[model samples]
Target: MKFPLRLKFFVFASLLAVAPLVLVAQNLTRLTRDELRSAANEELTTVATQLRTEFDSTFRGRWLTPLMVIRNAIDSDALGVSQKISLLTLGLEELPQVVALQLSVQGSDLPILVTNESFSKRLVQNGLDPIETLTTSDDLISAIEGTGQFGRPLIAQISETGDWLATLALPLTSTIAGRQVTMAAKIDLSVLGQLVKRHPFAQRGEITVIDHAGRRVLGEQVELLTTRSIVSSALPLIVAGARADALEPYTRPDGSAMLGAYAFPDWFPWAVITELSEASAYAVSNAITRQILVVGLVGFAIASLGAMIFARQLTQPILSIGQVAERVRHGDFTARVENIRTGDEIADLARRFNQMIAQLGQRLELMKFVSEGTISAIRKADQDGISRGGERSSVSVIFTDIRGYTEFSERVAPEVVIEALNCYFEVQTGIVNRHHGDIDKFIGDALVAVFEGPDKEQRAVTCGVEITEAMTSLLEEYPEYNLHVGIGVASGEVVKGAIGARNRMDFTVLGSTVNLSARLCSKAAPEQVLVDQATMKAGQSKADLQFNQLAPIMLKGYSDPVQTYSALRHIQP
Candidate 1:
């Protein structure tokens, strides 16, 4: 259910390739089946019409010959009653379909002249008394008279043996004798059975002729004739007088599925239905469906194979990039994707990833040159600090200047001055760091720094004293250099930040605190440390430190004289 991208792409491509072929096969099968059904219906309808035409012509020809023979005998003056009987007998013998011929006075209950002695025998065999049934049968008399009145042939009742016979009666007018008589003939209808039997409607098909009462008149099945009603079954469309050709499905008596095509003949009160097994009718369509299925399966297989190869080619570079990215995630910046020459988006992405890795390597190198304190300040600036602009904070500022630094630089070589400066800075930096002070910057021969947090003033004073002791030790090691340091400590509020132009900036402290510290450094003598009153009071708790209050002096840029203190040495207990 949860297929990967490659498999999903392959399946979709296969379907896209095979869909049109499947559609074409389906449409072709449907159209062919429709055509076959139409052709079958037309063939059955034509056969029904032809059978009806033949039945009409054959039965009418048989009926008219007997009628002419009776008329000729009645009109012949030379023929007596006995002679007329003989002539009618010859006519009846020649037309085997004519079962009986009779002559009766118009209103008489008895027929005066009757041919065919077998007629009475046939009636007796069918459980009828020849004397009473023939002479007193009201239905028989009514049929004969009604035919004469209507001037057309009429079908009589079926015998007990299920045979159809017709009676035709005509009025014989004897103008010379001034009397009217009727002549009637009985004809057999067994020819309809033979007609239906001779015609086969379809392959594996059965042809049936049903009469007006839904009874089967003629078909291959003898049990259906005059016994079974088609209306009682599912085929209600198979009825008499139906004018259009139609096909429908139903189950046969044996419980087999069948399709029937039916039509009503123009000349008979019966419907001709041709039935074929449903499986046989659609056998060709089933074959076509199987063929289409095979073709569709083959097409899909071919499409899937091609899609697999194509998808692999498309995703190979992306997979390589992913592996390289994983390596980089674990701090392996040296790993990179290589040998991708497709020149598409994948190639472009590989190039961008490599460029990012190279940039990371350069940034790591740059981090080594930056001091930890400066780095922390930059990180703090990124989180809302001096990086945006500047801020005011309470901090203790310390400044140290090498006494006679200008004279030392003038006399010594440039390399010697730089070497001496580096040595001095190494000793001072260690002291400041031990006291938890951040060196703001070194300006030529001067060191400027700020200390914050609790007891920053005491830490600054301790750092200043340690810096002087370290410088004294350093001077003894390098006797060629005459270097001595002076330190100043001030505690107050100062504005601290990164300031300057966009291209150049410095993180430093400004305001009166930094100014006061610089002024104290200027006032100190060689190897001495000076502090303002605020720094002295902040360090008073340190009992071992000795501080001497200096004379109040007027400092530049201030109208009032500022009080100061000189830290001499630690007191011996």
Candidate 2:
């Protein structure tokens, strides 16, 4: 079994390699999802903000400003009624978006009016003043009160022209002859339609302007303005009393899911919203996630394939060694490896295997006492060329001992005690092996194990706790044995390698850290696990494990008392 340790390592190494790829792939998928959401919010918000800005600039300059100038001039005493008609006629002709302009005096029923050529001539033939009629609505009262304000745009159709138009009323700044005169402009809906149409998303996705009441002011497919069942759910927040931005999930009238964002001009009551379906918005990131997962899985599959091949290649020699050892186990000391050659670690391993077999043959009595982990450690050294002369390295040492074993043995039969010990040993060894720990040796009722590598401290602490719990369960099963186990774990610099006379060497770890662990184990109560300051500080539990601080204890070989932490349970023992 000189190469058995390395063979097992091949399997563990495979898991180690693939675990990170799996974790990274999962993390990448999550990160991509979040990043895509953020980008969607930014893109839609930008589009909405740009449209709002365009409306602000266009309304202030081209449409609203011109009508205000005409309002101020006619309200003055310098301009007579005849001169005002000519000026209004020319002003209406100059602004194409303005379908008509009405200058209304608060006390006068006959108000001055001018109409664009686009306006249906039927309004005049039918004795209807289109400007006065539409402007008479209560929605324009604030604009008509000489506040110089812009009223909310209203969407309507002219019966005669059958054309959709949005109206905006721009009020006069001054009162003339003790009467309020307001200039109202009837603008074509195409004015705002063109603003929305210029955006790219308006083609692939929906883009439109919606007032506070969820009325569609400028986009196609307008729903009737109603109080109940508002069209855009985002309308409430987006068109709140104070204008603010909104980037939210929206559902279309057809119940399709959409990601939408809206923006409003400073004084405007309408919200310009840009929208795209969720599927379309995250399409690119989803593609990237699929590619990442595919590449990661493919890479993991290739890595797994290599691990199997390596495990097989390494297994062949270990199997040969196993067969020979199996014979040796049956008291046939003459067994030897016959057909293992690779001119690599396996070739060197073959020589070591033969040497171990010869040594086992020479000292059958001594070999019987060696623990399996001690044997594995020797083989690991032989396979890797690690010196028997030990080196100093950071390691976590674990010590576990059954309490009251002597008294229990005194009451029980010799065979019973041996069988009980064997059962406990089997369970304990499995626990240690699974945690990547190697048993150094067994001293009567006590077992010592060592763990190394980056996470050795945490693994050692957890192993100690599990061993304590397992002992508790085992005690219940073997109630007659009447025993409990106490365990200790400590991490620090240690000398790790084979030690003792060459003829009877044992692979072991030795240092003050080992002594501390042994002493802590002795101090532990039955069914408890104890760990040194180093283990407690460096060991972070992956499980929902809690630790309680223990008073410092003065143990043998230490002048100062050592700090400790109890890990067996949530409460200190």
Candidate 3:
């Protein structure tokens, strides 16, 4: 406490007199809080579990069967485009919640969209057209792109009515009339409100759906809930969705308390949360402890003023440092404790900590510009620092490039082109990381990734297959973007090293394996993955895909044609 001798003595005497009574009051408060918390947990668990089951039954199983059948019928070449439309119309009847169905082809600006008769009339009443307005609407565009859902159950909200809708697009493996075809359906999510209304717990508490971000996806709040208060306090527990107990009671601004519990569905990103508003019943416990605390307050009144002064002076700077550290931990490196003026060892510690943080921030910022593989190499380098030298190491290299980006970019706006590229990279990067590969570099629309260790070839081939499939899905789901990818994988020896000017250096791998991969990528068709003989042999056991032998690939550097194998993008069964 840094207390002077006389002040310490005075404070000690005062605390000694009040200690017994303060202990009694604290014990009562603890006991009361625990009892109330336990009861709330048991009740909340039962409610949350029941709601979770109801949600699974209502939402998860409603779409797939009919959608899959419709998808298959569209793929059948026996059906003409009008016949396909007729089948889709019938499928719409089969799934009443699905309000609209749309069929679009790659590289086309217009699409065929069909809606239920009532919704079509509603569109007309709103001065809209099923073909023109809904086709060009932002929400429909987001749904086609599957913005939040990745590929299925694509969700977007109608701004005009504040209603949510989801889309599920089924793409044809065989192109119709030389153009790739996709069938999409818009599902009304107001069904969520209907589902929740059936729950009898409404009079006791509120039960609703929320996203991972704590936004009310669907609840009593019409459309998306803009209010941040109702369940935001319990959002972390809601997202975790692993606990079976209720939240500790939290008080609202009006002083009424709430108990909360949440459960997640296995098939969806949303969670179900139930909250009950209740009166706090701790008044009896407080009343019983009131007299004891009153006696203690008098005995400690003389020391309270000095204690508060000491705590404020001593702990405020420490608290600021702690807060900044917390922000730093969460990636806000800009936060700093700049107000410390203690002028003691604590102040010195704060100064050094800020300097250390600044240096770390600079290093981390630089790290993003380089490949993760390069970073790994640097980390494993000798402590004395890397020399301008290289070592031979075996690695599997996978190279990918966007197949028709030049034409796509020429036709699309520059910003739109960038957004499209980012989408492709995001999908490819996650696939690479999951397969234990590290990105080597991104050269314009081309990406190079490296995988090491015993299973490098298998990992590289699997990563390439995933990238092809992911890109295929992204393009097929939103064929409006009209882009595709070609990937190639090769496994061989390469020179790995840090080499450049003394002032600037880069860690990279260089060999025929890298060149071979690039050449195969250039020769690959859109949505195709080509692998060298070594990589293909090494990856024969990869269950996600199997290699199909390709014709010999002749390139500039090699006298003999290089043998290659391929894996096509996943075809939905």
Candidate 4:
């Protein structure tokens, strides 16, 4: 079946990586070889696009707009000349695309300013002469008569590396006169060279730029054609377009077999070509070819045995994973893949399988402790304890709330708020766990937890008091968070354990106890622990605890005002 070039490439690459030497057993496939070469050329064209984007983004889009605006704002022709020159020079340094920018006036042969100060000074000392270094086959005076933007490629030879540079010249004004200005910008080849140097394929790959005249403008070691034209070489292929173009692998003058040609951007006449070695491109396949030869040398009589050994070596990890998966299906969570070490996808699957089994084991252990029915209830409820059909039970409720949570969260990033919440939960949960409290759920910036459930009896008030005191001490120790909490405690007979229908269940407390505790928590101010009269009487406190009566406040769904009190300590003056 026919496939898109990219998809076909991925399939070819996968096969090459697996059985590289298998190609040697059969006749050389021209179609497969052409596909590989096409893929390589496509990759080089992609890189060229990346280069163009980088250049445009760095100069034309981001850094040049301000300079152009300044140029347009020029009122007087006299002072604007020097200012424009300086602006152009500044543009070169600020932009990565512009290697150099020089403004040459129509009246004088000398460039008014060159962006590189060192180069400018050198030109002055040597008597500025464009003819000596940069020769215009056609005079510049005639070229600047255009009304709009006019640009062309020039073969530029610079001081740095003798690399060919892409030079662009644009008329500073709409019309040419006795005195007009022109701006010239150059793209540094050193930047492209650096990219090639850092690239993984540079040693086996080549990037070449051929100009409009079919001359070798800028590239690595590519010999220019003395007789035949680059125009003749590229014109017919250019019509075929972005991915339809083809390259014939040819032997270079240096006797190296190199894949030729790549893509050219429509914006410019220049063609970018990449040449890579067949040996290096298909190195893995060549290695497999050698392995097949070795197998053949060992003798055909034992070929089946050798093939079995090879197949086993490749799939041992997969087999081990299959065994582990079977064990997990039978509830053996500890089963693990054995003696499998490969970086391929099989190894990845095996690792994920092992992790899955481990998670299953942990869940099974949780199931054992919480009872089968409770485990089923919790799983069906999700993380939030929202379920139907609430019942009544004797449950002790506690609420720890954060003061100024809204303002605090707003002041920081979302991630920072989450991180702080995690740290706060760790400390709060540790205190609850120590007091044998079963955490119900978090409600915004507050936590709702319960004491004396299932096994515990008659110690709800003591546990509740201990949790509050412990949390208060923790807040004082960690002043970095600037945290404070209001805790409330209440005890009463209500629906405990898992509440809701058989299909849906929540491990939470309901009835008046939960409602009273929540109301008391809301009444407490920052850094205060407020308890309802029920909880206070149940605690049987011995420590010197002071309480101040707060005004009666009406609550939601309650007809009468509830009497509230704030826990406080008096300081003797």
lDDT winner between candidates 3 and 4:
3
Q: In model 3, where do residues sit more than 4 Å from their true spots?
A: 1-308, 341-352, 382-384, 477-480, 569-573
Better of 1 and 3 by TM-score: 3
For candidate 4, lDDT tens digit of each residue in 318-374? 667777888888988879886667787878887788788888899888654443335
Local distance difference test, each candidate: 0.73, 0.75, 0.75, 0.59
Model 2, position 521, has a per-residue lDDT of: 90
Off by over 4 Å in 1: 1-18, 75-78, 112-153, 156-159, 175-180, 219-267, 273-287, 293-573
Taking all chains together, the TM-score of candidate 4 against the true structure is 0.38
TM-score of each: 0.42, 0.43, 0.46, 0.38
Query: Which is superior by lDDT, 1 or 4?
Result: 1
List the lowest-lDDT window of 10 residues for candidate 4. 129-138
Specify the highest-TM-score model's number: 3
Candidate 2 C-alpha lDDT tens digits along 47-159: 98998898888877877677777766766667766777787888888887777777777767766767775454556665666655445444355544445445655457655
Candidate 4 off by > 4 Å:
1-24, 27-45, 48-70, 73-82, 85-89, 92-111, 120-138, 144-149, 159-161, 174-178, 186-189, 219-222, 225-232, 235-247, 251-257, 300-573
Question: Model 4: how far is 519 from its true place, Å?
Answer: 99
Model 3 lDDT tens row, 1-573: 575544665576667767766776788778876686676566666677776776566655777567777888788877788988898888888888888887777667767677888876777776766566345343454465565542356556655566577766666676766887777778777777666777777766777777766666754344454243546644665467444434445555666677767666654556677776644334455666677677677768856766667756776777778888999999988988888888998799899889988998999998988887677767776877667778898999999999889999999899998998888898999999998888888899999999999889888887888888798799888798788999988899999888799779988889998999999999989888999999877878756667889789797699998888996433446
Question: How well is each residue in 107-193 modelled by candidate 1, as lDDT tens digits?
Answer: 556665554567667777889765543332335556656544433544434446566655566556552244455566766667767
Any idea what lDDT model 1 has? Answer: 0.73
- What lDDT score goes with residue 412 in model 1? 92
